[model samples]
Target: MWLWITGIICFIVAVRVIYNRRSGVCTSKKLLDGKTAIVTGSSAGIGKETASDLARRGARVILACRNVQKAQKVADDITGTTGNGQIFVKQLDTSDLASVRKFAKEIIDTEKELHILVNNAGIVAPSVKTLTSDGLELTMATNHFGHFLLTNMLLDLLKKSAPSGVVNVSSDGHFFGKNLVVDDLNYEKRPYPSTFACFGQTKLPNVLFTVELAERMEGTGVTTNSLHSGAVNTEIFFKTNKITDYMFGFLFKLMAKDEALGAQTTIHLAVSEDVENISGEYFADCKIAKRSEQAKDRGLAKKLWEMSEMAVSLTQEDHHYAGK
Candidate 1:
């Protein structure tokens, strides 16, 4: 009887510990009244919450998403809730190179200044290998290459808006992806790994891209960083396997954060004055965090940048703008 009572007490304590734990929050009070910010994949999940938070802080927030209708609805909701009518929706499909270029061109043509860019868009690798029309692996294209091209294309504006920031939402899962062969990034000459492994591979590039871009952007006042949002109950898991979705949903609800909590690190990286000069770093839970060894490889980072440029068919003009 005493043993049973002890077990019950311990169970209650464990439950409380799990439920009461919270992720770090961005405590910055900086207002972005005149700032123009773009958040890709802002239609839902962490991206939506991140965009909403920026809008609430008075930024003219643009929802860069693939689904125009869904993004518009999100923009409306953000405007209604925040009373910041500056929220706008623009179409962007990060998996498609053409769509990335189109979105970048429009932003450059219209927006006079860009203060923040949140490369929060990402997708799960399918169980089977998939390829984009551009002949790159679909997962790599969307999660890394597309953002790579977009950021480079907008390099001039980000630089012009001195002290600007580029926040890449990466993941700790990158540690498992050191096997990423930069030479054959698209898996064209190699065997396709499992979905999770492929997903991990894509995440590593996000950090590598941040490291490389930050180095290239030295003296430009455009800080670039990457982060791992704590596990959250997001829809990225539901779009893949039906059988596993239910299990994942249950597990996530019990162990994961809500979207708002998951957005904290991203928010911190974007608007906080604390990290205004901190670039080429990885973060988690609103604080600087250590990255994987592979993520620290400057050689790999440089190689990946060159290959990504070629894969995206970055023009001489685009290269000039980035180097300028």
Candidate 2:
């Protein structure tokens, strides 16, 4: 009987933590009045919440989404709620080079300075080896390379904004993907672990991108950071869990926070005045956490940057990917 009581008490405590939430250590105050933000994948999940938060704080949010109808709906919702600001929906398919170029040209043509670039758009499908029309792995191409190209294309506007920032929404997935057999980057030669490795390899690229971009952006005042949004109950895995969707169960609930909790870290990195000067840091649960040794490897970071640039068709000839 005593053991049963103790178990119930522990269960209650765990539930509180899993659903735990706060306004963050940094003030929830609006300090982003004059900022302009571009948030990719703003139709749902953390991205949507982050856009809303930024909008409420007085930032003009450009919703870069792949689905035109969904983007319009999200824009309508945000516009209705945050009347003090505007939400511009821009169609962007990060996997398609043509789409990426079109979006970049849109920003370029508009001549509006982008102060915040949230690389929040990403896809995590099952173990199948898929490739973009550009012939790049689906995960790496969308998650890292797409953001890389977008940043490079918008580099001038960001620089003009002066005190700009870039937030890469990474995963707590690098530890499981060290020294990934590059020869089989597509996981075709040997069957890779379906769920884990598929996402893990792309996450590794995120860390390297952060490190290399930070080094190159030393004097740009354009702080860059990646984050592991602490396991959240977002739609990121809705496609993978048919049983969960069917049953509407909460088995992973104890380990999952809601989308709001996940968006907290992203908002912090994007607009908080506390870390205005802080850059090249990895965050977890809204706090700076130590990263894996692989994340700190400058050499690895540089190599990954070079390969990614090539994959995305972005090079120094345009915007000096490597700081001169």
Candidate 3:
């Protein structure tokens, strides 16, 4: 009888967990009537949901994605549901340096006011080591370096809009890396044991970039913050091995937050008045959270910044903002 009672209690607990995984909490419906926002990887998952939420608040949202067709469809859906037709789709493949340059150039040439920038696009580490066209590791190129370049290229516009915000979608997996090998960012010297470790390595730079960028933009009024959106049930884990993917799917179904919930912290940082003056902070569950020691290393942050400039070939002339 005791065993039977215990079994029933466990079953009830399991059901509650699954329910929460399916239904996420609603974010505050603060209006952003005239703001122009860019959300990379906005075609699906947290990116898509975040974009939708922003549109609902009357923001003109640009769904920057690699696949124009899918992005167009997402834009149409958001328009249909929200009755906000200000959504536009643009091509942006963050893994490629050329593509990043093209996208930034187009935005800079076209847009008048740039208010919110969400670097929400990312990929899980490849099962095997792969190199991008720019001769950098694929995961590092897509997750960190590409966004690094894009953000820097648009820094002037963000500053001009003053009080603008940049939201970086980092992950809790950053703690998995033992230490960042600044010299071997491409993982040529030290072989990664698994793609998970490689993924973690890239996330560290996201936080470090936020730290250093916030410092530079201190008086510029452009706040930059990073967040761990929680273990979300998204399509990122689908590209791995069948067995591994299935296991992750099962676990996520039982424990992961829905995409909407995962996007709260990102939306919080982007449009929340509470964090209007806040910068260089990491967030989780819509609150400021502590990051790993390596993430907070000021010296390492500066080193990474220099290395990123070298990787992207950013010159002094590229920096239009004198102080930044």
Candidate 4:
């Protein structure tokens, strides 16, 4: 009877601890006081939730979305309802280099600094092999290259914000990625169902970019990180075919989390005082977490970056985000 009572007491303590931790996380503490944040693709899904969460937390949010009108509407609603209207909206299409550069220049000319940059805008176009204006794979171009270019463009501003962050929203799907074919990143030689193979190379690029960025931005007071927001029931999975769709629909029933939970980790990093200086880490479950074996390989990360640069024809000279 004594042992049973001890076990019950311990269980209750553990449960209470967990409940307090989650409660503390969920209360919207307004922790991001006075900082400025730019959340890409804030029109919908996790991005939208992230924007709202940041705004609620006292971050001056800039909704860098492709749709200016929708972005403004969301911004307006956030400010009007919360009574914290410092939110700004700008048009940015992560898939297009020209738009990215243009947006960068506008920020440079207008704003003096940036605090958090969440590379959250991503597109999972269907199985079709669509190409960007620059003729790279659509998903790769939009999800990775676009953010890479944007980050490079805003490096000066990010550096100015010393002790800032650049977060690339990656995925667990990076586990499936293999050794990148440096000579054929665009699938010019082997383009599988762009959608089927999408989860692999795309997420791999995210990790690679984070690793490379952490190196490039060392000591600039800008830390970088990535995360898998879990199996979110967002539009990404909707891009799959009927068969894949039914399978995922069933799978997500067990794995999926709401957009609020999806944004939890992002908000945690952007504002939490403990992680203010933390960088080059990946997160899940509202905490810093480990990735797969492949994600741990710096060699793979370098190879992916080099191959990606070659594929996109990106060079230091092309870093300027000026007109077109």
Clashing pairs in 3: none
RMSD of 1: 2.7
User: Candidate 4, TM-score vs. the true structure?
Assistant: 0.83
Which regions of candidate 1 deviate over 4 angstroms?
1-22, 320-324
lDDT by residue for model 4 (8-124), tens: 878756754554345224333647777888999988888988898888878889999998998888898989877777888999998887888788778888887789999999865
- Per-model C-alpha lDDT, please? 0.90, 0.78, 0.88, 0.76
Mark the regions of model 2 whose C-alpha exceeds 4 Å error after superposition: 1-13, 16-28, 181-184, 187-192, 241-250, 253-255, 315-317, 320-324
Pick by lDDT: 1 or 3, better one: 1
lDDT of 3: 0.88
Clashes of 3: 0
TM-score of 3: 0.92
Residue lDDT tens for model 3, 143-193 = 999999999999988989987999999998888754898778987898854
Task: At residue 52, give the lDDT of candidate 1.
Answer: 92
Q: How big is the positional error of residue 134 in model 4, measured in Å on the Cα after superposition?
A: 0.9
TM-score winner: 1
Task: State the number of backbone clashes in model 4.
Answer: 1
Q: What's the C-alpha lDDT at position 100 in model 1?
A: 97
lDDT, candidate 2, 171-280, per-residue tens? 88877667755445555677656656667777877877888888888888788999887666677666554453423224434456677777898988887777788888
Which ten contiguous residues of candidate 3 have the minimum total lDDT?
Answer: 19-28
Q: Clashing residue pairs, candidate 1?
A: none
